[model samples]
Target: MTEQTCGVRDVVDLGQDDGDTAEIHDECGVFGVWAPNRDPARMTYFALRALQHRGQESAGIAVGDGKTVLVRKDLGLVTQVFTEADLAAMPGKVAIGHCRYGTAGAKGWEAAQPHLSTIDDTIIALAHNGTLVNFDSLRRELIEMGIPFRSNTDSEVAAKLIGYFTQRGHRLRSGIAHTMRMIKGGYAMVLARENALYAFRDPHGIRPLVLGKLGENEWVVASETCALDIVGATYVRDVEPGEIIRISDDGMRSERGLPPADRHDCIFEHVYFSRPDSIKDGSSFYLMRHNMGRRLARETPVDADLVISVPDSGTPAAEGYAAELGLPYGTGLIKNRYVARTFIQPTQELRQRGVRLKLNPLPDVVRGKRIVMVDDSIVRGTTSKQIVRMLREAGATEVHVRSASPMVKWPCFYGIDTANQDQLIAANMELKEICSYIEADTLGFLSIEGLLSCVPSGGYCTACFTGDYPVEIPKSFYEEKFLPGYTPHNPDPSASDASISISDIAFDLKESENGD
Candidate 1:
């Protein structure tokens, strides 16, 4: 990583952009732990590290042991935000943490969460993963009622809403249920009081939340099964949609936060957001992607000398593609795993040079060959076009690009940061037009039916592809709900309170945003 300033940045990053414009960004990741007599902070840290791919903008952890609560979070990666000493200082039996991308609030320390609020003589810490469609209205209502807020995040709104209800007369679980009824949208939230850890999901299960056990009494909950794996916790089961699970000294109890309803869990979790190793319900994400690729090969017969994936995200599908086609798989594109976020002079040539820094072609492998490039999906078409051009320059005679998922024609409001529908290349063009635009000899996307067939037991959300939303979405909110573009606001060194510096930027879109 390049340092524009002399000092090392507090921001953390792993280098190399995948140069694929058709990428989907994930929303957030949340993890919590309740160990009877052990400090759960370290366990929470390792779990957050495993979930780092879920969010890169910021991270934080909060811990408590019935009487005292301590929080440590900042705007960076888990490795950058906390040291051994830092975790050692806060030794608590219960803890929860968050890794976030600035979706609901401005990009600053104020927006980072594990938001804390003390109301009615009770202190609550919350870390959430998902968007609240009605957050704006709720925030305004709470403001008018004389409830003070600490941050500009929708997470804080939910935390305060729970506190507001609790102060009135409801018990903690009852207040959470009341708050759940008042809110709309997908959420997988982990909340902590002095002695208990609570995990809850939206009524629709639009996001993922799993409950796990470390031993006889310890319990854990996280946005994905991967976090549970990182902590050596055995997967217990998925928290049911509309379920609220409380883990305390007595034991773990499950209660419904919202009434039972049809589940429309985000399909992207199977397609992108989740770690490949994670198992959702009974289906493995790895096996699902493999099925998509195997299906792609059967659906689209291509005359190619070899097949290759874009890298980690596209690898599984590429493996299936090669196996089904009986074609050899090779690493035609070598990704620079360590070249971090860097600033180049703002020149046209330098911009193109940056793409090469992320991915360089293996001339010996693709030279004079017909190549079929398998990628998860394409977004703006800019990165795909560049990659195709790069392949040609390396002496590839033809480039046939295939996407494992259907075209994304709509913007996602349930946490994913897909560019506006207008920004999506597929939203504006036909298959032939998109092929020509990206300079691919041919381009194919897996059919929606084919995508769904991978999972036999399915109630997944494909709203981004079919425009069929499971939950109520305020379409008008899109213009402001997700920011117009990908860039975070530039930091000014002159500002005394600026938490960011030239050295510490976890830069945007260029990196591997493999999941939604």
Candidate 2:
């Protein structure tokens, strides 16, 4: 066990560049276990570290020892919290863990999860991934019923609701079923009790939850398949929408409940949210993104000397695009492997600064050449503009931007942290306008058909791009303002108050009823 104390400043010093950025949405990762031969907490810690890219705000683990549950959580990176000694202290064979990025809760220790509850003389610990559109209404109802709340998180409501039902003489699975019926929006949950571990996904499957096997007696549930791979587990299948699976010493059992009339797995999981190595619903994420880049190159051809990727996630797709266009592929940008994800930064200033410190353009390769920069997507245009400016300053003759996914026009009510519609540059601007704003010579985005074709399984949720939600979304759904010390800057006085509230917008179209 290596014992070393390193702070955020020390980590920042290890960054690779000075000025380059990318727009992205923040997400959470969840992992759990039922029965295992080894200490489940240590395995979960490694799994969370593998999924640290999906979230960075906090990391936690809850373990069950057949009679009691023990939990440990804190606000920081996973590596910072779970040391070898910490792992050794957490003794258990069944555990559930979480890596959170605050979709709808305060960014403090209280909101960090694996929320524990004692109801009906049984300890239940929960770790959730996804956002609930009806959180406000649910909170009000729970408060009215005299349920003492400990944290300002939407996930807690689900835990309390399930506890409430279980206390009324309902079976554990029945309580979860009843709670699921009342919730509205996306969720992939892991529920732990004295002797069992349970996993479930929302009816619409807006979020992801996959099942894997470690050994003959051990079963695992994780937000992405990459986690399972890191722990030497074999991918079994995804937890079906509206289905609950229980794992105990006896073995694994499943119950199929009422599924939503529609199914829409989050498309961003393939584009930017998930690790490229992960396999979602039997579809290779790397291949899907690579195919998207290939299609983008065909639809919007650009005369460029070379194609360069933004690094990490963009590298695979850029290679595909270059192959399709017969252009020389070069490493134009170098990423700082040690830099933390900017989207996970709690403050706006920190997010902006993090991006600048994350990536740098390689002047030798891009200088005196026409560069086609391939990236996954652009959200607010802040990162895109900065990256374009960096390339030009680095002596690139012309910079052409290519996006592997369609433009994001609508705020996601499922789980992603895309709250304000106005903040989205693509939502209000045309393609030419967006290109001009980003100062790019040319800009191209993947078409809807191209995105759908990329997926081998032929099912995805592109609601953020096309406004086609798979379930009945709340008209008033919006991300809850929960970051403790963070606040938005007020708009200029001279500007008109064109901001629209959630209730006024008619989000549901007639096509939503058709369940496409």
Candidate 3:
């Protein structure tokens, strides 16, 4: 395997606007291709490059040459992990790739995915883009059967389930179908076995996944349509929640794993996760963000001379706010894109210097004037405080901070990186307290109503704001979900092994690894 590094001076992690404090991240991205007579691995590489915004810590691509599954993954950006020669060496008819931020499990080379496992002889490689809430339950169940796991990642748990089910006389479809029911929480996954590519989503469709046509019969499945665009594929449609699609040289066949239920696709995609050029749930990403900024302006108008963004993610919202309020918009913060994830553990001094390292206030824009700052969300309140201080230091007479989305007060167990609610400033502080905490003259957030006005309410997950989870999470799971190093024990320790039956988990292998 070859490793490469292009001379990219500045590479920042994507989908994280909250700086320093509780860097809210989208978590992971998955991409795959099924193209006969073509180098599927190469296409997957490029597609993963486009979806890199979704993940940054590690990358891998697995290719199936109709007989053997080959995998290479390590902790790094896509560009740093794979070279052109590496892609050329793993030529195959089908390929699946992953860029990981690790929503669940520890971060390491061992945990980096496109997790490869053998379904007896038919090798399968899988990439995942979400967390599984039933992790402890499933792990303990499998452990009871003496089935050991290879990694700490929940994706490995999924791979083990597939391998076990396939080994137990279930067809690839049936195996995946059963596995889907056993798993819970948000996920968009791509798996390749022997000769076919399979993609599926959570029953609630808590994460985004879309299908696209490359040329003629060749197809693509990915976490976002933006990946499809990068690979020169024509967008098809989103994979229906709880639906499974298997792609091969013959064609594509689909089946449902779970019946259509209350759709709860993550609302964060339109708010901040996706690229503005991309589309989600038939809505334009740019328009959604623009409309959010529009609603934010109307709902939370502040007296200020000019509007400015917190650099990149906040740009569209700042522009919309400026236009809506009839105030001039200007670039008050200059971002140095080259400075990305630093290796050193930031000291308190270094952390305090965080804003200057990435963003420098353009004094000329804010000098002796009132300024309005528009940002996506406030996570820990530290970043907002730093930003307000930066603006004040730049000669702004007053600073008003406006957030496009409602305050994120709850932990997102679906796929977001927020681990504990205790870290959320909104979860703890009132608006006036938050304003004082951030050191801003005023602070306002778009109401849930105002935020929903920007997009259709149906199928959108607003559990972060409303706390009404579409899928019921066991109360046993919450405190353990974010509290690090917590061990799992039955709520009733008196429970017997008979509590979870393995009678349905058979061990026979006589079905096709693919539909073929």
Top-TM-score candidate index: 3
User: Which portions of model 3 show Cα errors greater than 4 Å?
Assistant: 1-20, 342-348, 480-516
User: In candidate 1, which residue pairs clash?
Assistant: 15-339, 15-340, 22-378, 22-379
* Candidate 2 worst ten-residue window by lDDT: 7-16
RMSD of each: 13.1, 11.6, 9.0
Off by over 4 Å in 1: 1-22, 339-350, 479-516
Better by TM-score, candidate 2 or 1? 1
Cα lDDT, model 3, residue 215: 85
| Top-down TM-score ranking | 3, 1, 2
Candidate 3 RMSD computed on C-alpha atoms after optimal superposition onto the true structure: 9.0
lDDT of 3: 0.80
The candidate maximizing lDDT is 3
lDDT of 1 at 137: 72
The window of 10 residues in a row where model 3 has the poorest summed lDDT is: 6-15
Question: Which whole-number lDDT from 0 to 100 does residue 508 have in model 2?
Answer: 27
TM for every model, in the order presented, reads 0.87, 0.86, 0.89
